[model samples]
Target chain A: MGHVIRTRTRASTVAAIVGAIVVLGLALLPLVAGRGLIQDMFFILTMLVLAQFWNLLAGYGGLVSIGQQAFVGLGAYAMFAGVILAGIDPVWAIPLGGLAAVIVAVPTAFFAFRLAGAYFAIATWVIAEVVRLSVAQWKTLGGGTGTSLPRTATRDIAGTGWIEAALDVRGAAARDILAYWLALGLALLAIGAIYGLLRSRRGLALASIRDNEEAARSVGVDAARLKWSVFLAAAFGTGIAGGLIFMQIARISPDAAFSVTEWTAFVIFIVVIGGIGTIEGPILGVLVFFALQKLLADFGAWYLIALGVIGIAVMLFAPRGLWGLISHRTGLELFPIRRRLITTKGNDHG
Target chain B: MSILSLAGVSKSYGSLKVTDDVTFDLPEGQALGIIGPNGAGKSTLFNLITGNVLPDAGRIAFDGRDVTRTPPMRRCLAGIGRSFQIPQPFDRLTVFENLLVAATHGRGQGEAAVVRDCADILERCELSARANDPAGGLSLLGRKRLELARAMATRPRLLLLDEIAGGLTEGECTALIRTIRDVHAQGVTIIWIEHVLHALNSVVERLLVLDFGRVIGIGEPGEIMASQEVREIYLGIEI
Candidate 1:
């Protein structure tokens, strides 16, 4: 039989074309956008990166980790240690931060694996707190008091001089632009990687496991192996995002780096509101989150309360999130991970 | 040649014995029917064979290889596929995708084989029209067919069907029986656990009956059904 497996629909085919153009447009946006806008984009892109990783873990892998902030903090602190103690350039230190998170994640994954569901979420949060406490004792990176990147390191960061000359801007503007480009690039890589995994057999396996673990196992799915791989991969991506986040600010401390509200809560909110499993959801989720923040930031306490109210409303009215609702109405999947069966019955299975 | 043998297989939940030294042999490519009242442990036997539950004692050999310690998936990969009493389709996945998982992971087939196998199995089960529908949205009959279709996609040598006829309309049951007969005709072994006597009677030549986890009778279906002991214990016929 001549049969084909497909994920793309007619809408997704068109979306792919438009999406590529949008990416190209986004790349060129830095050329014309002002400094503040680039900075804002940096925040949104990094949050999207973190949200996508979370989506992969909880949305597809069936892992609901509440302590992803642990990786974020670990990554940020690692960047500080690399720059301050190891005398590494701030730019190169970003990858070091991610490496640090991976090192910590290996041991944490084993511990977290023991618990499941709600317990797993709690265990991750507790471990994150422990990580933050452990890092707090290290005086070399300013200990409990926290510290900033040295002036010399910040003044001559990797790609800073080149970006300044190329973009024809001030030193501060060059720094922002450099961070902006890096954020854009990493966000694209994150989305691409998630899409790639979801398209492969691995994605099918994860989907199987998430639907029903026992049923998945009965069908020869190595549920444990698939889950562990997803957990670790998400941790690595989150670590990279975390490092980038703090590197943009050029400051780090256990409390600031590991703040649950800043790193984990906001990321969870984005994924939850956007649509947990699909690649398009987080993009929409982040924009909505930013829009809400901008409108409500002046309200302070009202802003936080309003977020809670809206989150509840969404959960009740549309449990699948905004993207899920949109997909149901429009049937447009930008990153199609679902397989379609194309059958040529004339060629029978002999 | 015997394709499977369960010798002195036993299992218990606390003090309740679900399977007490249950033993049987199934010949290659022969369709066998198992009948029992509620709680007679027909499902437990299926679990033992499929590796969903480990037998407390004795050996389970498949094609002359001891597989007592093999995990459930390995048992499936080793050519033992089964359907749940209640259909367990991967609900979020499309019916086609559900079959694709079996053809790929369970059968270890490549892309071309998977695509062909899934399509063939879907058509065989009369699910070609509903292939694009999400499994969760399928009607009961469709879900049941999807279950059988998914099991067949694994290309199993021995298929264990647990109550495949339960909750089906007479027409649906007849359709399923026809499909099961066709599967049997292809020389694939079948071990069906069902309460629906007529459905079982249509497909299997050999019938095995259980009561309280012990074999009550085993023979040709007509011989066993007409026996005095079966009439007294199972049929409870006064005439």
Candidate 2:
């Protein structure tokens, strides 16, 4: 037992160090890369965030919600409203978007909680469509045509006017670099937060509830409360990712803000390929997903088909997923939540 | 004091009655054994006691508090810990993780304490050697041990065992009986439903028999076994 604890502690320490190094590398990437690459990296970082949140929800919480796009669209609109109408800064808009997503999640959870199993999944998808339609119909925000943020030359060019007027051209690059760092920082925090949560008591309850709801309830776990909490957290995380996405693109429209196909597909692919239920799976899956996307960009529609096929194949052949399969074979866990007694002390302890 | 009492507890699904006007008192620290033939609604009685299914017409009192409409989790928190007839462990989690979840959530214990309690339960259940194995991969005996470990992790004053020794070998059943005796000595109340008459005979002093959702016999295990009603309904047939 003592040895198992020591091994787990060592593994966690190694994971922490690796995580710090990855964060540092991401923080420094914008400095080394050109503006285009930095922009692409920002997009990928947002996708990583989305994937991690979805992975936590469906993979660990067993929610399997298809309507997460409701929060995604809500986040985009919240950012747009915060920046354009409320006169909030772009950075502050990200959290405001998350808050708005939470607000929407409250009602969504109420209706969605009434369902179970496959019905719940389908209900969430319907809710997302309802939100999308409602948002598209709101004339004040652009309705069907969709709205655009004020992109004055001052805002359009990265760090152009005010910073340039204050110092030299280097100042503008510095500001853009700061924005990239901000996105990277948020992504890392999301991963770290999820990792910590999965190691906490609440995470264990969620896992128990996921694996066997009947048994969990029999043991005094409030399944509804845990499911709702995870649902809300997932919405909040996806909302933040949405805001980052719009920030990277510097625009928001109904169709673009509510693009479930892209966000859901990418996140589902990442979790399915990397491994569901492990904190490290989303990170690894995101990296592999982006690598494939970069390599197959020229394939256009085929690229998406390839992603779908891969996801289906992985689900069929490797239900444990890549990380799950590896962990099964090697018994090496980076995030060790349980202590296994390696050697029995025999009748003494008994 | 009676920790739990059921008064005229009746439950039905559509036209079929599963638990018919069943009444019993579980005094604090008492170990009660329930025996019945297949389809005697023994499992349904366990479910009703644990609040998995609401009693259609009855009153359930736990620790002198009414809990007829209470949810399953609430009943669990109020000191009811039950295992399924077939072992149901969290398939994706390791044995230790499964118990850790039960310890933390069932008793609402903090992380460190829950961990300690989970380790202790694993050791007591003789599952320490396979603690790291995924629950889905466990053998029948291992799975049964995990089911018991999970229930024990709840730190319940009342533990309900639903046919836990059903599929085990005679030797395994003896081992499990010994474990239950140890737990009983520690002052935990137990309600065991088992087809293995000898297993219950070894552990429990009192026995109750059910048939067609109604109590047919209740007395000391030896006397209940000798009763003509019980023998004809359950024990007369070959083992």
Candidate 3:
């Protein structure tokens, strides 16, 4: 029998069918749901996008960077600079944020790749702080105290008027729905792109490097190049998510843009709680994270303590994350990366 | 002409030199067995040749091209493959996937070529039954086989085997000897550092002895075994 490498399972096929339908259902939520619900989804979807990019960087790329907020804050700042200073439309400026992040990633990779382990993690945090401090000095975008987009710019964002008419909602509610949809699209794209990359040949090389870096070099895998590329890609995607997120909120500040606790720490928690390596893990992780934020966000300092407690519990018990626990019990993988050998009927003829 | 040549290669950590001015020649398709007492720098010699460790004073030429300064990956891509003294397979990957990485990256084989070559390798290494299992789950013999299989996947012109038969039982050692013999028959040059004398003798015609990071004897396997100085240094015989 001839071998055919297969990663897709019957369960995965079924999961994809159900998952597609579910995403479609989510897309139509703004039609029937209240503005508050739409706004909540915007938060959840953007966090999912941010979390997925972080997972791809740390989980698959073997680069555990704590400075992801550097990109988020930079992207948001770029979006603001594009709209307020350059007179570009806000919708058009969104992609400019992603581009700005990618441009910054080149220099960041050179410095970051020089250090490893805890030193590398700390180096990233330091760099992020530097970025925050630097951005705070930009007087054009409102210095240390921070600034918001112009009233006209926020009010005249592309598609808001069209969304208001189509959804039969007021202008404000329409903006919320439109931003919610953008978050949903970004979330799907992030997951799909990561899944695709992890299944490719480069993904195989990346896995080997993560498994054993020295051994990977012995087998001719260029560890440095692969790590650099994954880092830049994660930065690019994170920047876009950051831009989209801030655009929805219509405000920006150096501290708010580069908040490590809000962006990086929470993302790490989601991936760890849900399962860092698997794509399905982040979905499960983000859902759990969003639920906790909504339900207990106002319990004062106790809420932070509760989040810490739950994060530790999942990490200690599950280790692989919530999706890991689910996969272990049910043997189901919605986004499988392992290849299986199957025998084909035409093997003998060949 | 030698397929691999090492001249005056030396390395030291502080004052303790692991390899001191070591020099050797390996002709095409020749199988040379290296036997040394513990801490004799036999494995260090292998690392130097494979470019995992650079020599302080030496020239290494593979296929008549100098590769002393090349990095490990470039040396690997240039057709030098070696197994670790301890197996270092990617723990989370399946056995087939480990080989797939080597075949693609080390040998630069395309997708279809890698698949076909990997199947043949798995069968040759007697790992087809466990190809789908994680490398970490393999038995001792299985892990050793994987180490060899991955190195072989690179399609090396010069293969270095480090203590491959060290911990195997007699029966397993015999199987490994046969595998090594088959590999030699395929015209790939081999330099094996082994503690298992019987296993080394069966596959290699030439034997080189080392002591205190210096070569003590180099000749036919029987001649090296009969040398008086080799007996004193390696076997600790008074004669």
- A206 Cα displacement, candidate 3 (Å): 0.8
How accurate locally, in lDDT, is each candidate? Answer: 0.88, 0.81, 0.88
Per-prediction DockQ scores?
0.63, 0.60, 0.65
What does candidate 3's lDDT look like per residue over A1-350, in tens digits?
A: 67667788999889899999999999999889999999989998999999999998888888899999999998999999999989898888999889989998898888878899888899899999999999999999998989998988888689999988887998779888889999999999998898888888888898898889888999888888899889989999999998998998888999899999999999999999999888988889999999998899889888888989999999889898999888879878888888765456667224
Candidate 3 to native Cα RMSD, angstroms: 1.9
Clashing pairs in 1: none
The list of candidate 2 runs beyond 4 A from truth reads A1-11, A153-178, A340-350, B114-116
**What pairs collide in candidate 3?**
none
Residue-level lDDT of model 1, residues A303-327, one tens digit each, is 9899889888888898889999998
Q: How high is the lDDT of residue A224 in model 2?
A: 85
User: Candidate 2 docking category?
Assistant: medium
Q: Please write out the lDDT profile of model 1 over residues B1-239, one tens digit for every residue.
A: 88999999988999988888878899999999998778988999999999989988989999999999899989889999999998998998999989888878897766566787688889899999988888999988998898899889889999999999999999999999988899999999999998888889889989998877888888899998888777766765332
Against the hidden true structure, what lDDT does model 1 obtain?
0.88
- The positional error of residue B53 in candidate 1, measured at the CA in angstroms, is 1.9
For model 2 chain A, the run of ten residues with the poorest summed lDDT: A1-10
What TM-score against the true fold does each predicted structure earn?
Answer: 0.96, 0.93, 0.96
- Which candidate leads the pack in DockQ? 3
- CAPRI quality level assigned to candidate 1 from its DockQ score: medium
Q: Which stretches of model 1 miss by more than 4 angstroms? A: A345-350, B235-239
